[model samples]
Target: MTTAQRLPASLTPLDTALAAVLRDVAAVTPVELALTEALHCIAAEMAPLRAHPPQDLAVTDGWAMRANDLVGASSYAPLPLTAPPLWVEAGSTMPTGADCVVDAGAVDAAGPIAQVLAEAIPGQGVRRAGSDIAEGRTVMEAGRPVLPRDLLLARAAGLATLRVRRPRLRLINIPGGEATAAFIADAARLAGADVIRSDAPGRDAAAIAAALDASADLIVTIGGSGVGRIDAAVAALSARGEVIAHGIALQPGRTAALGRIGTTPVVALPGAPDHAFAVWWALVLPVLDRLLGRGRRRTQALPLARKIASTVGIAEVTLLARLQGSWRTLAIGDLSLDAITRADAVLIVPGTSEGFAAGTDVDAYILRE
Candidate 1:
């Protein structure tokens, strides 16, 4: 038998095995795109822009005045004005010879003459030019993810277009009897990668080989990657390509195959939904980061509400219940579709000692939105 003939109980962390396969994988080239299409994307550098108000405008409804005109004004004895004070409504332009605004409600008018009830301050109740944004200010920096609210700010800053880096990725996908492989393919990894699919059985070595040869920077195949009849994924890579390592020391994802077809690395994963997810998290994910030249994925540590034990030396990945906002162990043995449907995240326990305590903190990586 070959290396692919082994099982999950005989494997290491998917990350470790993948490191061996992706030997010499290089980063792809970057491209520039418009700001709108750059949302949720990575950029190589920051862009600078600024905004300035057109002219002084009224921010409130009041009477425009020379501030000194309101001196000693009071409700009982109002100040005498030369002519009727001009009305300046909110958002109106500053009136001629006006340097301040006294609220019209503060004083009433009698016989075409208005009285001031209190004193007014210079530049008061006025929206100054560039108040919302300063001149030559950096509105949207490079490398920042474009948010929905960015457009309005950008427009206010007087920018209609943005320059950003585009993510480039190449996918190598393996098909399963079910939609599980397609589920893995649909994932947006390391920013960008087009998923490629195949329909051959897991054991068809010849068919699997042709699929890998088509076109892809990375190779991923699903099903028959584990120990079973045919074992086409293993046979395809080991015979036609280079086999880096097979089998793992983890549970639920032990049958993972790490190898290379031509110079590109290939990750063969189990067909189960949860298992495929596990391999991608442990193995394929980091490779994506390395290829894309990005940082490792970080996660918040959430304490487990329940305890769990592993059956073997192989690392076991358990589905989580997320009780009371804390990640709790899921019923693994049940493995029911409904149970998986209700799961929030998958918890991985390293293979070695028997089990862990209920209050232990486990890093629960989120699976869905």
Candidate 2:
């Protein structure tokens, strides 16, 4: 049977529904970007350049001389210099014919005359060429996100630019009167996508089709994804193309929809601000990462400071706050902006388990820019 025919007029499992949403997603093409502008972008291939120090240099501020010249030298029987010793600073190239550096405190010098009071070994206190980074070494691997330190490494490797992938997203606000559009746009941008937003008055199919016609890599609708009469995002998506899944087994976001319009992927989020944010974080962001060729979000395990109840058959997402060195679930049923602002993490309660009690360990996904 087809995927749509398998729907049971009930909520679908979160993982199963998300898999359908991502099945049709195609990764964006890679493009060359200046190293400075490649931050947060995924690298298309291994860095091609190499970083090799050109010459051997001194690693300490001292006097440069042949090691043989300092043999048998000690404090009781100091060895006087036959000729002036060459002075070298840290990171300075060694003078010709010099094989070692004696610490400044080990040698007593006055003008052209110097006395060596300690033994020296060849190659001591010297940094060899390519010691830090060898030639032909891989600086960065493909599918790795470009970070600030990665850029520095690329520059040090003689690379002026790098090939990266950045997904372009088109956001359509169905029932556009809500104020959650801006928040959605910001979240998309934070996921390393270039976003263009459009508003459709009360689930107008024509407006959504027009936004799809703009030819973005992916299209996202912010509202009108429920069973209510005004919830027409699913119908609009069906009119344009195929609807993959209509209802996910997720609290506060069970009405989420996923589909495709021709070759482009589309995600329909619920109207409530908190529900929209939850669906975006749990479902849409993973698909966006695939299109952008980026890595998955990082998660950490933490103990719950209090009890959190949930239905046995439905997955629930709860806002988390770090209070007094422990994670506490915020009160649900309030979708206000203030609640979101106060949350530092997000906790997901699985559908198979009844719920988590105080001191039970749970995985928390930390929110970051």
Candidate 3:
């Protein structure tokens, strides 16, 4: 019988299944790598070795003078300086007793003395010491993915490397599931996982079982998750290790399964693109976050532009688009390729709740940076 024709024997609650998937899974060991190598990896706590702008510095290429010396000095009535003020270039350390910088034209260094024609404020055009980065403060908190802007701060602080955690993930693609496998691989990489992808030799339980490798921190098998005659991923996992959950109470991903080979966690995703996509967000992300020690995810609070009706017994994935400062519901339950492609955020409706009413303020996870 086909998967559509067969009724699931029992469905495990999404929360129960997720908890099992994360059981005993610990964060990967953190490593200190060069900034170039740590890009996109989860950042470990980083404290600046030294403060930025080690001393008071000039923010402009001009003359550095005490503000009091240049006060009330203007073009109409120039103030003659006892001596030419120190000339400092942009980013250069400001001279002692100089709390402000004046442009070149503001000071005329002709004849026997220099005349100042610009009024200056105490801190005008000056970058104070430790203003950019403090010595005792942490450069970045742990769990946020390293970004280019983060590298800028590290470079300025004279740091050659940063500590980060990158979890290794293995993706097993069953025969005829290349598209979904590739899609999931890209998404995993975007989430800072080091993805290793391989194809199962055949469709049988033995072939899928042979492809399972416990070396990776996590293993995800695509396809063969349903109860159809050809579906054998769950059986393959059971043969090698214990299956935690066979069926999950997730719309479009009900056939998904969770298991473990030895200590490494394993997840079997449905072959369909939409179904796999839902499972990736709902089930797989939690496992990935746990492995990487990610603290929190980006979420946005916005009112719903339309009402969302979902069955109370099963968890549903809702795709949304940001429009006119509110979240516009694009797809719920069975997601289409177009809807998934156009979605800017995702909201999961719990099994206990009936649905969210229109204009209800909801917190949805941001899909894009």
Candidate 4:
């Protein structure tokens, strides 16, 4: 099972390769999905036709009255009412001309006339119209992932479904990389992709090429991307399409490759989990974002607990943990399962820069929401 070594002759810059991959790429057409099903999907603009609480509503279970009627009402000199005030429960619509609510203790109906024993202020126990959501205002913006809280607004808007762009991703597993492929597939699903996974019959070029000839917005091949004799993913992709960049300037994932099969963009990832994970963040996710029409991802700028030095001309992945309000370096270049599991954020060191100095402010993508 020993394969010969064949290193790359030249490494392509990360930015250059990324640009080439994104060239001519556009977001997928949007589709309507059930509100709950749209969670994590890239959302289209969500604006309500009308405001929630279309009319003023009572905020408490009590009698609804006009503020002016009880302005001078007090315990010693109770004000008499011509008629009993309308009763309203919490969340019920207020009666016409009624702008205040009072507890049962504040009103007495023992005599012929109802008495108000407490003063009231306008809007003291009322939820005004459009207070929860304004009409014609955007509740959810396009290109952002649908969150659970967003569903609250959707429900208020009386929306049964949401419009979203969910790209279809096909992951082809070259033999001997089932674990890595499974990991990538799960990650893609979490990113709101409709992931379809299949395995190549063998590790040969023909088997891999056959797997690459499927229809999808994006295709990813796991394993067999290196120049080793049996590593044939690059060759397989070349046979069916174009290999834009075979060797990228990325540490731990230098063997990763990018290409396209006709209109479908393809990425060849190494079998190693850490290597694949690095490329997933550094390369694959960007393409996924483009297809989803997503905007800038959430990131935080914080001072580093220590210096992170990197080799010039190669991009390196850094795993970080937020310790005492600062980023503590957990692992760099080669990542372990423990580090990956414990990571709170991720930082990518560009190939152009050597690294960041201690106490320097660095931007890192937040891993946990």
Report the number of clashing residue pairs per model: 15, 0, 0, 0
State candidate 2's TM-score: 0.81
Error of 1 at 119 (Å): 6.9
Candidate 2 lDDT, 1-369, residue by residue in tens: 112212347778888878887886767899888987777777776654554565779999999988998899999988999887888999899888898989988888855678898999998988777776677776677777788888877776777888888887888887653577888888887666778888785455555555554478888888777766456677778878888888888877888888888878888888788889888877888888899877656776778898888887787888888878788887443345676888888766777878888898887888753
Compose the digit string of candidate 3's lDDT tens values, residues 285-313: 99999988888899999999999999988
Arranged by lDDT, best first: 4, 3, 2, 1
Q: Kindly list the per-residue Cα lDDT of model 4 for residues 149-257, writing each as its tens digit.
A: 9888888888899999999999999999988999999999889999999999988888988888558999989999987788988888888999899889998799999
lDDT of 4: 0.91
In candidate 1 the C-alpha lDDT for residue 138 amounts to 63
**Top of the candidates by lDDT:** 4
Query: In order, what is each prediction's RMSD in angstroms?
Result: 5.1, 4.8, 2.5, 1.9
Q: What is the TM-score of each candidate against the true structure?
A: 0.71, 0.81, 0.93, 0.95
Expressed as tens digits, the lDDT of each residue in 176-254 for candidate 1 is 4357765676664324453455566334677777666635667777777876665667778787688787786656667
Runs with alpha carbons beyond 4 Å of true place in candidate 1 = 1-9, 21-28, 51-178, 189-203, 213-217, 238-241, 261-263, 292-298, 331-339
Q: What ranges in model 2 sit over 4 Å off?
A: 1-9, 24-26, 58-62, 65-78, 89-91, 96-128, 131-136, 174-179, 199-203, 226-231, 323-326, 331-336
Comparing candidate 1 with candidate 4, which one achieves the higher TM-score? 4
Question: How well does model 2 score by local distance difference test?
Answer: 0.78
Best by TM-score: 4
Residue 48, candidate 4: alpha-carbon lDDT: 47
Clashing pairs in 3: none
> Model 1, residue 134: what's the lDDT?
71
